[model samples]
Target: MNLEDSTALQFDTPYMVIDFNQSLKNMKKVQSFADQHGKTLRPHSKTHKIPLFSKRQISLGAVGVCVQKVSEAEVMFDGGVEDILISNEVVTGIKTDRIADLASRGCRIKVAVDSEVGMSSLNESAREVGKEIDVIIDVDLGMDRCGILPDDFPGFLKKSSGYSNLTVYGIMAYDGNVADESRSERSRKVASEVETLTKLCKDYERINGEPQTVSVGATSTYDLWAEYDIITELQPGTYVYYDRRTTEYGASTMDEIAMGVVGTVMSKTHSNHAVIDAGYKSTSIDNGRYPILIMPSGDTAPVTSMSEEHTVCSDANQLKIGDRVLLLPSHACTTTDQWDKAAIFGLNEKPGTIEIKGRGMRE
Candidate 1:
């Protein structure tokens, strides 16, 4: 894909645009931090599922990649990521079987679980394959998303202990509350969360009788957790494409933002609002009520309103017909899911595009 002379060639009304230079910088920063802290850098691939980005991450000394779904793990494995960890629980029979198959095929795979059902699924699949599947218990520090409480963890582990084909790897606790914008509050939350996981690690070591590998923290709180020496691996997905929210967390600035949506001005409305072709379908608005827009000069334009097919930005008079604009989405993961491919930009040329291999993983 030679994009050197592609020259303003519009494909669709809206598409994902990536800055290769900024992305490389972001990757280097995260990798360097992980190395400095002696933590394994296992970036989450769900942010930018492009194969080229994964290769670059591995080249930057990333031990492996982290994903949430089985299909995502499969895609990354096929893309030359030899080691993978599904940071979330995999309960479905088919998904676990697929994971087992991947493990049999020589991909170093590890999955998380917070329930007996999830463990049984993986154990059964591993039994069928006659192999041992690495496992981690996901703990709920505060985010009521998918992990189990710290107290219920023992039972969850005990139930799966009898399986000879299952190796209890460690615990994965993601404290999303640490991503709070308030610096003092975020620091306190990260400290407490790491402390809690540290206690759990000691307790598990006492009861289960072995050293545990704890994989916790996001890109926002990784710096704090890295200081504690409790977390063994860092799974910060959004660092690859820093979003507006992550920027608020002080992980990266607007210039460090590597992902953007290239959109065209479609309509001129009120004096305060200008509409763009990219909407909910083109750029995901799932993070909150609004999205972040970027201009030609690299300034962000606030999203005043959004619909399925249109997004209204502030300062309508500033935009003209057919004027191209860029947008730094609110949530990089959700926004990247909106595109099938990303235009990878170079230092002095049009952007080269790469396929988002691990998308829409639901069966």
Candidate 2:
């Protein structure tokens, strides 16, 4: 049945829905932005966790897909995505073995490493499988997350030279800390980070040779990074289906957000508040921002509280029992992980189910 029709209301509640048309537009816009700036678009797959969406992104000119875990990369590889990058470090022996296995199976898999230990583990695992794995040095550009310091890149590069089973592909940095700042402030911060990265790349080339890739940026700093001459690739994941935080940070508007939770009003115990079937289990609260309730009257209400099975909304008195509400989640990444499947719909099309193939791939 056509999801745009009223019959869509009869399927089920508390399910994630994606407006395919909006999502396609978002993908195309980012692709065009990257193409115009001479940057490779390697969108992170952790946002949607759907291989079908990854294929869509690739078809729209994305160079490849970026994953956070070896298992997530395996999922994408199984789904026919050939080139995959584990954009985060994988230090565990089991995870490294999986990466080596993928390489032995003819998958072009590259991973990020921040330390000698991680490089050694990856090299040993690759050696055991009689294969070589490509790796990128993850530089900590003020995010203080999982990356080697800019000053420490030389030492790491020297250590990496000893690993014959590992090839140093390039460098990667994630500027996640500047996502919520104003565009001007974010550009300033990104410029500084880009300078550090550029110098590091030059220094590495001087010491050894030119690296293959220099990756950077998130959804917030994508446009800023596009203007730089140093960055070779862009890795912005959330632009596909922006969330409440994206809108709040001015990265995307609410109308551009393509994903939402369709829930049923289960109770109206108070005069000014009501309960819905979706709660923390359905939407993410990691950013301390709750989902916004899209009321039936084309208005909005604030989500006051949420438990495992209930979402309490303030000023939901206009909603009655069995009423439907569309909730825009706070963070699209975590919210996508909460569901195993999504109902994808578009104008003049039937709603179809797509498996969240990369879900629960925390390893």
Best by TM-score: 2
Q: Which 10-residue window in model 2 sums to the lowest lDDT?
A: 1-10
Per-residue lDDT over 1-363 for candidate 1, one digit per residue giving the tens place of the 0 to 100 score: 112222144556587777778788889998998999899888888888866688789899988888888888888888888888888888889888999999999999999888788888899999999889889888999888888787787776676577788888788888776586577777888878877887788777866765467887787887777887767888888998788888876778867877777788888756767889988887777767466676655456778888888888886556776877776678888888877777666734655677787767654
TM-score of 2: 0.96
lDDT (Cα, 0-100) at 278 in candidate 2: 92
RMSD of each: 2.9, 2.0
lDDT of 1 at 318: 62
Prediction-by-prediction clash tally? 1, 0
Please give each candidate's TM-score.
0.92, 0.96
Which residue pairs in model 1 clash with each other?
344-352
Candidate 1 regions exceeding 4 Å error are: 1-12, 269-272, 297-300, 347-350
In order, what lDDT does every prediction score?
0.79, 0.87
Q: Which ten residues in a row have the lowest lDDT in candidate 1?
A: 1-10
